[model samples]
Target chain A: MSDVSLKSMDDVYPQSAGGEVRDYFQLLKPRVMSLVVFTSFVGLMLAPGTLHPFLGFVAILAIAVGAGASGALNMWYDADIDGQMQRTAARPIPRGRVSKDEALALGVVLSCFSVLVLGLATNWLAAGLLALTIGFYLFVYTMWLKRRTPQNIVIGGAAGSFPPMIGWAAVTGSVSLESVVLFLIIFLWTPPHFWALALYRCRDYSRVGVPMLPVVKGPDSTRTHILVYSFILVAFSLAPVALGFGGVAYLIMSGLLGAGFLYLAYLVFVHRVGVEADGHAKRLFLFSIFYLFALYLVLLLEAMVPGMMVPTGFEFKV
Target chain B: MEEEDLKKRKKRSIAIGLMLVGFAILFYAITIIRLGGDVFNRPL
Candidate 1:
């Protein structure tokens, strides 16, 4: 028997036959949603004020939905390219499970719903930021910047960075230096993280006609840029410590993790082109995920542990 | 023709089921621990 038959008769079905609900969910990119929710929740928790549990839940729900809306819109716009890339070929729009028009409509509905509900439930500031995030991700990153320039993810990263600030504003109703620091952590982290992937998957992106850095600038330049950004990320990660939001634990974690990131970038920089370079780049890319998650987790832990000696100089009053 | 489609549908269903289970584990931790919640609210 063939592998397809041995695996289960159900494996014979065409990919496009999935229903609307499942396809719609696929557009949300739930893994990305998890990161958005986690970072936003960190922002809310670290904010100076307090929110009722129910209200806090609502705010996070809205933010997550808005993130999902943006993801759907991105999928809709990138379907043409997505279909060509092995990494993205299984996505709803690319797989023909969801129509472009349907994805667009669902995105619009969720965008409005999230923003309005967030504004009404929290404050106008957070709602406005949420709306801006959707617009920036959809219009700026997806439509304008992506096809035009290799620096797309660099500037486009700002959309993803907004969540922490939005979560902060949801409670405080205004942006603060601390929230800005949180935003910077993610913003600065993006280039190195994404460029690492680009270095490994440059061919896939080029095949799909996307102007990612590795495709447009060559892998050598992309590696150098990754090293530069990784250095900057290390500096920015330490800002919370300098700003006094972090305690000893944060300092130690940031120091060790930042060194690890720098080491990976160095390896990627030194690795020979082709397979070895790709392996190093993939290693850095994977480590970058764990690095950001650990960094934020330490921040949250510092906040919860009393007498932990948070850094004590920079406090922004809103 | 219908049989082939049904088979595909079953595969999709199983994939979705596995995804939901993963999400459920994540959501359960997020909702239950209320990891980001402020102090003074112990679970009732």
Candidate 2:
């Protein structure tokens, strides 16, 4: 059985020199890595203790590499669909810059290296979480959920959400409610954030048969879902303050950002399906990226700075 | 590739290699300091 499978794999890939270092790097999806690193850093900073700076850097690097590995694996699996979408058409595997087998090999190697290095340099707990992140991303999100349902991003968001918690675990070597809140913030933010993009890119998704909310349910229904998720995201953003994981800086930033996000969602939801609706959806998509980055940046700053006051009435022990 | 072109490519490759080595060393140095390593007791 093993020999048969190995023969089939070799047949599928043949032999190619396409898996150069640069091509492998392209598989990492650097933009996504940046977000992963930032959120993981915030989680580390917000954790109750300090790591040696070098160790902290190593931990973050490991997490970033793990994220990259996941991206590589995702690209390996999604190469077919990716080729069909304009936004993803130029990716290494789909463009034949790297073969699917080469991409898979790079991903597997990096995944093992990262998880092992993290376990040795940090702790088993962080290592385990990293493993879970990779597994969930590959198995639960990519393989099972991505093409199966319109609720894909909602569930798949958990894979992206793990970084902060992994960062926290790197420091504290344990899970906490605070880390979970950080996870929730990203989780709830993902649906509307992605759905907005889906609204404008609906045709691309439909062409590829990806079953995204907009493609599967029509733009009107997708608009309503975006509004619903946006409202939920706002609530989740404010929950950190109520949960005692954030300070005044975070509250004020999140409040203002949440209002902006809601307004964008409102526009996307109400605008008639035409050029105007497309423009509104695109605006929401762009702002969602900024909204998340700003939200997390404020959280990191608040955690780093001393004597930043939080709301008085808000308190949660766990 | 021509001989002159090959020479240029080799030079470019060497330069890139050197730059990568320098960056790796710098990264290691910064990481060691950040991780609270004792410079004097550095591992061989």
Candidate 3:
């Protein structure tokens, strides 16, 4: 829409060959799917009630497929920008391995299939949440907000953050404050995590005309934003412990992990320019992923291991 | 190139067939699980 021509596969590559299974699979963005599956599994396990193991597996599978459907839809819509960005240039649509129409069909079919299956297997609440996730991603984030706002990742982050809440709803058939807390953790963590990457890849985003924070507001402001969000994220990561869901292990882990995260963020904030600054930003980006994973891992472990949920002696009334 | 495209299309067909069969099985299993022993209690 922004002067970037949306070329179909035939237009770009007249003799382009058909896609293999691998290329079609790549359209789903499996790496992101894996993380979604893991977090949702953790959320399901940590919920108040228990689900049948087989049904639990089905719920996770449906959620993963739904996430993948959104990813495919996103790729279909962003093919124009995808071709311009170095990071996304090799994606199936851009590479002509898969047609944009094929991606759209796959996405739409999978979205309906996953949602219907989830509704049949579990409650409609979980299925509805899945539907909302797919819709918000495709309609709100991808179509509307991404190119228009520097806060794109900040809002688009909700799509990625919904899996755990959906998993929680699948087990309980209701939304609880605990599930909302899990959502907040990821929502707050998204800005800093993405901004760090945007800092280094600012040129790529600007070239593609995507309004990423670093591209729109410059690196200094983006660094300030990362440090601020990192502060809030670190503080909120300890909320589970206060909420009585996370154990003593989680308390200790969150404390240590928060310190490391804050230190990396501080390094990013302090180093303003040059290769040294980019290195710090990259470190923060990588460490942010590990920090969130470790925090969730500790919570998941506490839920799994019996006798591991010792009280931290301070339960605040929330 | 034509031969390669044909091969890929054939492979895609096989994948789709397998996925459809798998979907049917999964739905059947879910229906059975959700119904549980109550399914056996139904009158003929």
Candidate 4:
């Protein structure tokens, strides 16, 4: 064969440049999955009853897999919009590393596997909640609310908030007020956390037509909403203390951390129409992550060490 | 096409095989734990 013909054949049958395991792992949104795993671990550890160590490991693995499945499904559905945005354009599906059909198949298979294994390993209640979380993220948040309304993250945050409750149910076999409080803490924290990012990434959301708060409602209104949610989040973070689950350490930590969170939100609200404004929003966004993590960490520590959780001499009343 | 690409594909295949084997072993362990003493006490 001529060199020209061989070169043409090589061009037609290109060498294998395909996805690696890392690309598939990226489909799982590992950072978000890590947060889910941590919160759920706190839930499992804090519950009144004990789970066998092996079964606990299984439960957490299932929950983490369930979170990853939902993330893959979200990426599959959002690939089109993701391609249009600077932040998400590098995702596996958007970058052509993984096909949409492959992502969807992986998501569906893992969802079924995680739910079934969780039910077998732990209680059905935990499994059911895991299923609900995956469905809520895919159906309610990804398919419906995200495109339709600016309030997408507000209602959609419920999906992310369910992990600790599922973890609690894995051990206790039922939901309780403590788990609900944990759920509420995350639910309330999501808005300000996301809005801070939205304020700075306003152009990206607007270009892709995702209808984020800053895109639809304007930065001023979005700033106000962030401040309002920060207020509510700070107040609600104290619920564990009132509910008698959080100790003196939790109270002190929440108070100091909540004050810092609100201060950053206030700075975001005050600065407008400049790099300074975006800087404040970015700072709040980063601190908001730390705020939530520190709050949860303190709770987990208090649960782990009884000495750290000194009684506040406060009692719950109707 | 290239030597590097061929090596990557081989590594990926091995990783997948290991994952499947690990999953099967995990299921076996979970079943044994869940059944507790019942596995040995089963009827012959």
Candidate 5:
């Protein structure tokens, strides 16, 4: 649905009974923001430089704001479709907890505030990446790709992947292959992770006309894609070891976790029956979260204690 | 119900607004204090 349709239906849309502070906070999608914070923090820690404690705090804060802004904008724009979907119907905008105008203002305010503060706290490179992440999410993914094609997550995944790079750039003031490998790890992981959810919730997407992979390509095709993406994800997961950003500990942990991830994807692949498919997808989706977190946690540990694990000597300790 | 809802909304929005203003003030103070008298001289 577009702005015109929304305007036409404005009369039918329920007015918010007015919302609480928590309602507005809900618009930020705090769960997703936490992931953003964690990944970006790991990137900051791994980058071979130190930031002023105050400035470091500001950098993380700004990233959080930018992420929240993206979520607000997404909710604002997707409110209509969101109301139709089971999982998202309770969101602020759709549930009349917050108005579209309020959400839009919140997003714009947070986006500008985060970018400006980040630039002041860090450097132009990190700020620029932050700006791009916000723009890509609001414009490229939410507005354009989401409703149009099944490949939306494939490309839109880049938005989520940028946080770590922004964190890297915040410290090093440049992007390198090391930060990029981190980006690749998440980029490859998104499809399998999201497609698993889509496998279970294809009906929700179809009802909203969002053209998610399972809805557009059918569940079997989506499963195949999930398995293929899982293979790539496992490969990318171990790339940190090969690329020299991860040590033996990282390699061992990632290899073990990657094998587990591949097995879940295989389960998702083999299960064709409805209930069985949903079960596999649920398992895969949950495990994928753990898989990525564990990979990054190992890297963070290696950075904190180089004695524990030595990343491949891809970059020198600057 | 409507009256109570309206009151709750007013209180919530006001609280958030105040919180945001405070956040901004703190941010500005940190930047200004850290940068010292030369804060304005340095380009943001």
Candidate 6:
């Protein structure tokens, strides 16, 4: 009846496990990948030293492949829990679209290719950081902390936070305090962000025996933790402003964004699911995504436009 | 039957695309390595 063009899977044939080209792509977790690539690109841009343009591109590509590899491996290992959780139940492996062995082989291949190419293209420091990131995410986070403790996301967040540092290393062949600040911002932001999701999805995590903070500590405590981490995140957000990387525009934008973040966290903290459940936790969860993205956008903008927002007397440009 | 053929075609195309990308990256790495050690160096 409707004239809208329908893009349906009706034309496609199902494979043995219903696997498709897209199923393999899904194994890479492209949504998480966009963030990794953006942060690492910013890192490459923000570092002090110069890199050959072609080599810089090569290094970034390696980091991206490595990031995708880790994601695939995570899905491979977490397939069991993933099947139980509503949010992940339709993932390639869980949905039987891709086999575990296929995912694992793809992950290992990408991992080796990425790390070795990065070492050949750039310095080994960047390559080593990439390898460390991949290993830590797989071994330390996915295999170790995820099922064992409530602090899974808290510590495992470091694995997600390493791209900028690796990006800086890719360019300068060394790590610097500036990259550390970027790392810390993401580190402090992760707990509150993830905890908010856990607030609503606690039952799903509980059913799977995954000790997400809310399932482990209950909702009230989780709300309080969200508020607390939001505070720390606000403080960390201002660090770049003080360091000369972030200018007046960045400072003002970060300030407003941080204030908005704190307000949402407070709203989530005060509201609870009762007779009528207001979606405060969901609001906070959504806002947290916007907050991190906006902060990074402001930083990226400031870096591109040199003197537009340069602080009073301190001159900094990329 | 046509749908099945389309699916197979798609899979083959993707596999070829992935292989091409890998080969290109490999070629780039070899070129960089052969160019006198450092990426920043001016080629002789």
Best by DockQ: 3
> How much DockQ does model 6 earn?
0.28
**For each candidate, what's the DockQ?**
0.10, 0.12, 0.82, 0.59, 0.49, 0.28
List, residue by residue over A104-147, the lDDT tens digit for candidate 3. Answer: 99999999999999999999999999999999999999999999
Which order, best to worst by DockQ?
Answer: 3, 4, 5, 6, 2, 1
Name the regions of candidate 1 deviating beyond 4 angstroms. Answer: A1-20, A309-318, B1-44
lDDT scores in order: 0.85, 0.85, 0.91, 0.92, 0.88, 0.84
- DockQ of the two-chain complex in candidate 4: 0.59
Q: Please give the distance, in angstroms, between residue B9's alpha carbon in candidate 4 and its true position after superposition.
A: 3.5
Chain A TM-score per model, please list them. Answer: 0.91, 0.93, 0.96, 0.94, 0.95, 0.91
Higher-lDDT candidate among 4 and 6?
Answer: 4
TM-score of each: 0.82, 0.85, 0.96, 0.93, 0.92, 0.87
Candidate 6 chain A minimal-lDDT segment of 10 residues: A5-14
Model 2 RMSD vs true structure: 4.5
- Model 4 misplacement above 4 A: A1-17, B1-6
Better of 1 and 2 by TM-score: 2
Candidate 2, A214-251: lDDT as tens digits: 88888989888999989889988887787776778888
Candidate 6 TM-score, true structure as reference: 0.87
Candidate scoring better on lDDT of 2 and 4: 4
> Candidate 6's residue-wise lDDT over A13-68, tens digit each?
12233367778889999988888888898888888888778788888888888999
lDDT of 4 at A143: 98
Runs in model 3 lying further than 4 Å from the true structure: A1-10, A13-17
How far off is residue A88 in model 1, in Å? Answer: 0.2
lDDT of each residue in A52-115, candidate 4, tens digit only: 8999999999999999999999998887688788989888877777777778888999999999
